[model samples]
Target: MKIDDWLLEILACPACKSPLRAESEELACTSCGLIYPVRDDIPVLLVDEARKPS
Candidate 1:
């Protein structure tokens, strides 16, 4: 499922409050290197749920 364009534009990274770029099924924060997964079209922005950069 795809997030709305406006919503995507407004969504920010919960960790560093940086803008997120849309990936295949996740939103990635370029600044902090956090990958937030989208579950059922809903973005899980919680820091605890984010994946760390390898």
Candidate 2:
């Protein structure tokens, strides 16, 4: 829930290269709307591991 601003600034959606915004325990894509999980404060950015946009 609390990712560093600098890190967040560099994170992008693997699907669409869109910016990611921290949401709960996941990162939501701004373009494709993919939801990537965050575990132990590390982001899981694999496209296959992302949740479908809802």
Candidate 3:
């Protein structure tokens, strides 16, 4: 199952305490420009997997 809105409520960026938006197959933190990938509908909120800002 995918990470629901309830789960998102408690999810914060590891680098910065910012809200995230659902991107294509990932959750992106707008403030820090971190992209948290989602695998099998599960959000991988890891700093290593996060994409750096362009």
Global CA lDDT computed for model 3: 0.84
* Candidate 3 off by > 4 Å: none
Candidate 1 segments exceeding 4 Å error: none
Clashes of each: 0, 0, 0
**CA displacement after TM-score superposition, residue 47 of candidate 3 (Å):** 0.8
> Which run of 10 residues does model 1 get worst, by summed lDDT?
1-10
lDDT of 2 by residue, 1-54 (tens): 668999999999988898999988999998888899999899999999999866
Query: Candidate 2: lDDT of 5?
Result: 96
Query: What local lDDT score does residue 20 receive in model 2, on the 0 to 100 scale?
Result: 97
